[model samples]
Target: MKQRNILISGLSLVLMTSVSSVAMAQCTATGTAAGFAPQYAPFAVGGALNTLVSSINAANTAFLTQSTAFVGSPANPKPDQEGGGIWARGIGGEINTKNTVSSTYALGGNGSTFQPVATPLTGGVNCNTTTNLQFAGTQVGTDMARLNWNGWNVHMGSMAGYLGARARDTTAATPGINAGGSLSNSLEVPFVGAYAAATYGSFFIDGQIRWDFYQNTINDPIQNGLFNQKIDARGLAFTANAGYNFQLGNNWFIEPSAGIVISQVKVDPLRATGTLLLTGAGSIPNTTTFSNIESYLARLSVRVGTTIVSDKMIWQPFVTASVYHDFAGAAKAAYSESNNPAFEALSFPLIQGNLTANNLGTYGQFALGIAGQVAGTGWLGYLRADYRTGDRIEGYSLNGGLRYQFTPDML
Candidate 1:
């Protein structure tokens, strides 16, 4: 009887152990569902690229339209030299940032074994961005640093203040992001920059250099399904232009210009450094690095205008047409999460993903502008209606500004 009782107890204990092992077989993924979200990789990266390019282009356009068409060309009568001065300008506009985003994401690592089920992320996204820039500062002339030499005229303006740029996903029920609404992004970086233009004889040149930040913001950090922290990026961008001034007659003139832009941008990795609980025996590492982004843009423009002089005021009116193209290819982002050398990446439902964005090829623009100056006050003002004529990225802006020359007579 004793021997039989020992055998029964041993078998019962073995059976209990088996049941416990089977009960804990499921490897639960811990941390916020966002920690495991593979769908957002493309949406964030692609949206960010679109925003960066659009912002750069917006700054370029603002710089181009801020001034009048009356360059110091031999075709028109030369006005007396006006000393250094101050200027204040404001610009508010909107542009269409269309992107073709595609991604590959993994799901269903719930089984007891290591496996990844990749889901196609081909649902397109449409984001129209609203942009605002304010500029106010001193301009250099012959009186300041000999900035003007021979017949050359140069003035520098600074754009340093709070800038607003917002891009929201307007699509209907963007899949894999929420249960009811789409994911929206906002750029919180403050914009700052400077622009310079010089005119010598029948030749002219203008350019601008500005700092570009690539951070992205969403309305809700936590999605109904999953979400993560905001992404951060930073870079530098600059635009250069050159042109020659010619005349059709004493009152009419023609101007042709060429411009180019070059920039270097970098995107920060997601969950750069952190470890999440695996709910079983190990931890999940969160980290990903995007490829380097280097881009170049080129454009051409032509302007025709006439100068009108009257007793009370002088007016310069012109119309401009231009075509531009971006030479950058799409950015391909690589994703990885297994940082622990000892930890097995394929053990659970670990994710492997990739994302990319299409580049906007060629765009056109049309603008109408008028500049005027008071006969005796030495005060100059300009107003321009600028429009993007391309179907892919069409938009418009009404920009205006006031400038004053600080001369001895004024004092």
Candidate 2:
């Protein structure tokens, strides 16, 4: 009976020990699955939970700091976690992509003329004649442009523009007692141009090209006869420029630029008479034919300016000075001739003389303007005036235009 009791007790002890071992194994497996140390599973799990909370807190703090920096506020408490920094990245700069169109008209009059004469003389009967003349000319022009990107900040854009001129003289006349006659001349010139420019860090570069066309007509009547003349001319010009801006206090800035303009021109002249056409002639006889001429010219310019900006508006005022070199081309002739017999019989005297190579002169000009954005929108506008003085011509010009922004990426 003592041996039976001892065996039973031993079996009970083994069963209890096996159950405890299984429970310990299960705990070790769970610890490994949860990525914790097996000997200190509970403590390791608690430490990991605390670490995760700390990581989340740090992230929240960083986000708050960035948010505060964006709103021009450094010490403000965290509000709703909203994205506000994107719009502040380029706040002080301006970008323009719209087009601007403008037109201008001008008129001026000032000219002089002189005449030489020949007469017949006989013994005790002599006749002599001499004449001098004065006249005035009216000048008119139209100027237009497609775009202008002028702002306080960086920008990229393109422009297309044109300028045209017309001049006429009504008081010009020919001389002689029996030479009851009248003479007049008219001229028209047109130009078209296009350009592109980009700006970065107070610096900008631009390139442009232009084409010009000119037409001229002259009418003169002498001794009951009529004369007509026509001339056609064409020109091409190009410019490349680089500029820098200096910022001054009080909403002011100054920009100076240097540029080179190259131009080429060609001219053709023709003349005819009407009296010869009536005498068995369908074509009016030609009295003179002037040789065609070509010219190459160079020019330079500089500009200075400033700008002011508010929430919904911007304003800029600028001034520019420019000069051009003498032209290099064929010389104008004082007189020309033809073999038509009717021209020889009437002996029509020389009319207006031609411009010589030495007569080609240099010119300079000054211009001022203002450009800015409209209130409450991205629209742009400008007003400008200019005065030009030179050896060849002098005049004043005025222009204005507006543009509307069509794309966000353009600004």
Candidate 3:
């Protein structure tokens, strides 16, 4: 009964949020010419940029933390550094079930551009930046299986050339911006880190550190061409997770995990230029930049699965329920413009009030996955489908990856 009540309450919260957010008051055009409107058009990009930085800095997934839950594969002691064979992960850090090399891609969006602003300032802007994500990583480990409590690995990943997303804004919706404006987004992010894990019976703990590099661009095709507007954000993160597995007869097991990702992002001052998209007759030089943003993401998850093993291979199927809390919402940007000497002098302040995105607060996630490995061999792979639903947000992420280990054992 309590679970049913909680589910009902969650549904109500999302429905109410959607209605109040999408319904925007139409703008009334009063001024004859484009005064402060053209300069403020890029504000929407600021909000999207904030969302991008926040997502990149966060580490909110915990399904893989139960590294000791494999059937027929008992928890082994940490590999010996001196026992020496080929060290796939180096001598400093040994490999456990968590060590692997793989690449995966996720394609989805965080609602749409028709989202709502936190406050009604200079018009209104709705911002979100979740179109797609790509990831490839390498973690090096050891072979001696003695790593019961003393195994670690170095991990590195990158999304060097990420795909772009589209944003739509109407002067009618945002008040002072152009009447009909379209935006194109291009973003790139790459991160590198090292992680270590310790196991005590069926319980395990892991921690990682990541250094992130971010660069983004917003294009106005009708106005100035590429690179006219740019976003700059770079940072680092610390992530930690703990999980314990409980066997339920036969090959079935249940695991619960919790994790947290704390990130610090610094926005370098951006100096970019743009033209007047509203009135095609004139040119207005503008500047766009954002203040530094810091955020933290917390996640809780439980997974149930059954494993099948054979002489040559192993297969496992699992389902997971997860919840995420992302505290990274505010987007603070500063904009200014210098009018052409021959053009009309600016009558209004272009640096309007604060702009925001729908990236903060709590959300829920569910995933179904299958994993396969060649018994006694060092190769394995998995594929997963994920759905995220939350207040003012909904999206999907599909992932598949393959990994290679240095050593393996079977029943």
What would the per-residue lDDT of candidate 2 be over residues 295-346, giving only the tens digit for each residue?
3334455555555555655566667676655455433332222334444344
Assess every candidate by TM-score. Answer: 0.65, 0.48, 0.64
RMSD values, in order shown: 22.9, 40.4, 13.1
Model 3 residue runs over 4 Å out of place are 1-74, 77-146, 149-181, 223-230, 277-283, 339-353, 409-411
List ranges where model 2 is wrong by over 4 Å: 1-164, 169-194, 222-230, 274-300, 327-331, 341-360, 408-410
Residue range 162-226, candidate 1, lDDT tens digits: 33455443322334432222344455554466766666655666666766565655342332111
Better of 1 and 3 by lDDT: 1
Best by lDDT: 1
Tens-digit lDDT string for candidate 3 (112-205): 1211223322333332223222222222332222332254321222211121222232112243443333444444544455554444545656
Candidate 1 lDDT trough over 10 residues, lowest sum: 15-24
Error of 2 at 341 (Å): 4.1
By lDDT: ranked, best first: 1, 3, 2
- Residue 73 lDDT, candidate 3, scale 0-100: 20
